[model samples]
Target: MGVHTLAELTTFQVGGPIAALYEPQTHDHLVETLRELWSEGEEPLIIGGGSNLVAGDEGYDGPVVRIAHPGLEVVPAEPGRIVLRVSAGVVWDDLVAHTVSSGWSGLEALSGIPGSVGAAPIQNIGAYGQEVSAVLSAVELLDRYGEDPVWVSADELELGYRTSVLKRHRGEPAERDAVVLTVEFVLTDAAGLSAPIAYGQLAGALGVELGTQLPVADVRASVLALRASKGMVRDLSDRDTFSAGSFFTNPIVPLAAARSLPEDAPRWPVTPVAVEPTVIPLDHYTGELPGYAPTAAPELVKLSAAWLIEHAGISKGFRLPGSRAAISSKHTLALTNTGGATGDEVAALARFVQARVSAEFGVQLVPEPVLVGVEI
Candidate 1:
């Protein structure tokens, strides 16, 4: 096979070409390929479905490794629990559809998301009040900075709001430089019943009260419909779908900072983790041991990025004078490529939105996509 351009592989369709592309058909082959790349001192970019990427116009100079290991197996587990081990390359939606059709319940709410199974745990992908972290049991990953692959529990990944130890932040390397080879999910039989509905929008669309449990198939259909209406599901005819889903994550800020926003602004409480202190020897202690107690601080609040963007005076469909990229007409959170848009055009629009929102609300919006050679 020939080397393909990043635009040909990604949903955004705006990046430059790759110097080389390799798709390993099996898990062993994938591991070997990665080991070889690392041995050769090539920091190859590992791309899954390319749904959450924003590559720069000036092509990637390194190798592009694509995970192609495919298939799923029902692992033997405790009674009443179904453990599904899925290969990294399996299409995410296909897995959702299969599970729903087979009467499995846990993943029905995540219906139309675009990406591979391997990419889900990296960001702890969530929507409609459910996260993959909730169901993920373990992951098989090949450490880029280590000598071999290993299976780690989900808790060890430190899955949080749209982030994981495997995800690289703006200015820091990933805590664990690894490539997910497979994922194992522990789901209940549910006997055809769906998990309790949690998100208000999903509940309203399903005509059910929050916490109500509906049929798995019904929930999948409703979730898919809701996503499509928001221009989140992919559609070739809709330019709005030509985007990296939500461009910015909802900002999580301290309670005081959140309260400064207008009363009409949308906000949700985020639970905080407690920090433990290091113990010291009694003999090495200072003159007096300090008496201390850990009291819970005000809960963090997650503010809506879309609300800030809209209230900041950037309406849906807003675009720069010379850019083909524009805010999605159906959703304020998305910045779409209206055919032939370049990476710079998308970056410019994103920067414009960030600037406007920050200037108006005093809140800095962070992009959600993984940028390759593109800065905002």
Candidate 2:
């Protein structure tokens, strides 16, 4: 394709033109294409759904590789569980729908998240009460410096609160050089019952207790409805839906910083889960025992990013003087492209929000999307 328009490729619809584009639909083809590009001294920008991405208006000069595989394989597993090997190019929502329809119970709560399955592990995408890491088993990825694709266990990805080692920080390359080709999800067959409801809003909508488990399909429907209410689920006619979901991740700050906010502001304790204890045989144990260790102080707290933006004086639907980019009318966390918005305009709006939040609370807000050529 000559002079591909990146605005049409990304969900934000804000990028300019691209000189080279490569769309690969199969595993071998993608690997071969990357090999050729690498041999030519080209480090192509790889893309999945572009749902959580923002590209600059000037556009990119390098080659672009868009993963578009459409394969979904059912792996043999023991009874009471299901293993699915999905192509990285498969749309995430479709997979969720399929799982729900097939009575697979793990991914129902993660229903409306945008992007392909291949990109899911990069950010450990989560919503409602469920996250991808909860169901993910492993990913087959190609290590840039290695020869062929290899399966890496989910634990190796270092999944944590909307982040993973596979994800980039501040426009930098991912710490890991691997590019995901396939994702394996291990789902449960718990009589088709959904996972326990963890989100308060979701529980209220479903008319159930916080730990209640409903039918998997019911959970998927409720999650989709919840996302739609926030302008999260895509609707072509709704510009508010034309966003990269939450522009900023919920900021995790020190407990001291959180205490500085208003009394009514939403604040949640951030507790790190204890790792599994190592086991030692009685015969292997030495005579001397270790000394008592003090417990780590609870110092980190998660602050609501939306609340910070609103308290900083930016409201939902807030727009710059002459820019088409604005905060979502339905959700303060999202910055939307209200038709014909340039990448620079969105970036400006994002920077303004970040600056305002920082200036007000002395806490820096970080962008959540994978920005390509766009700076915030």
Candidate 3:
């Protein structure tokens, strides 16, 4: 029962000491730990890199299970389809770099986001106009209520924009509990060409048509470079990188409201059912637009939370008087611990930004990271 502080495990460099932490190196050991804990009436919280989590300063009182399982196998199930079975505990960007280096195309656009591969499909991670859901075929999970692992097709997970059934709760009419052990992605033999470059910047960088394909390695390089500029890529020495990636899911608003905003309100067609709103309104004379925009419609519009934060007068490194927690100096969306901060201080900073954004824009900024022992 080794113990460590959340500060030691998470990117945020905050949080108190956990009661007990267990790292299972193999699947059998992981299952055994779970079974033994269950027999003792303990339900441990599963953790990976702790990138997308905000542990309370008080820390978790229960057992913490860290999945250390590792393996990546490329199995050819058919002539053109290759199922890449990746352990859930694998660091995500490392896997992306690996796949691209091997001439694989599907995972390129998701290049630089932090956290483990196992946590990717939980929210169907997306960036630069590409999402993991498009390539995910199935997931192998250890049912919290059952014994053996079962394979659930992508459809069963009900993946959505930044959401999935695993994230949604079950039982309590909204409670859902299932631990993902491994994930399989179905990749195509594209002969070094990347997936159709749906994102505009990416397409521009590759100097190809929107639906055209470029070399997979080129696409990966471009995506990584772009992410690094925004502080989205994790850098241990850069305090700005001490975050859970984006702090908020881009808000998807109704098309009518989007259209009513201004002729230049940034918008893009999302699904056939919805529109995505970009934070930089086309008519936004404020000159405060962020780099990305949404391109969906009818179902919802994507709006940048970072844009809203700045628009609400919260600038980079904004902090309450005498508070150690502050907004990232390099990125407006991330709330960082400059030094000597606590969970409560971080939560306070998040609340201040949330309230300011909501009051100014009439749209609430929902947090992107999962909160443990604290409410945002």
Looking at candidate 1, what is the lDDT of residue 368? 92
TM-score of each model, in listed order: 0.95, 0.93, 0.88
Task: Give RMSD to native, each candidate.
Answer: 2.0, 4.4, 9.8
Cα lDDT tens digits for candidate 2, 1-376? 7778778888888898877999987999999998888889888888899898888988888899999889999999999989999999999999999999998899999999888988899999998878999999999988888798899899999999888988887689898977899999999998889888999999999999999989999999898999999999989999998889999999888787788888998988888546445466799888655653445554788999999999999999999999999999999999999999999999999999999999998888899988888888
Weakest 10 consecutive residues of candidate 1 by summed lDDT: 289-298
Q: Which of the two, 1 or 3, has more TM-score?
A: 1
Higher-scoring candidate on TM-score, 1 or 2 = 1
Candidate 3 C-alpha error for residue 75, in Å: 1.7
lDDT of each: 0.91, 0.89, 0.81
Q: Would you give me the overall lDDT of model 2?
A: 0.89
Q: Residue-wise lDDT of candidate 1 within 1-376, one digit each (tens)?
A: 5767888878999899888999999988999999998999998988899999898898699899988679899999887689999999999999999999999888999999999999999999999988999899999998877787899999999999999999977535789989999999998787899999999999999898999999999999999999999899999999999999999999999888988999999999888756567576988888554665556655789999999999999998999998999999999999999999999999999999999999998999999999987899
lDDT value, candidate 1, whole model: 0.91
Best by TM-score: 1
Clashing pairs in 1: none
Model 1 segments beyond 4 Å from truth? 278-298
- Angstrom error at residue 37, model 3: 1.2
Ordering by TM-score: 1, 2, 3
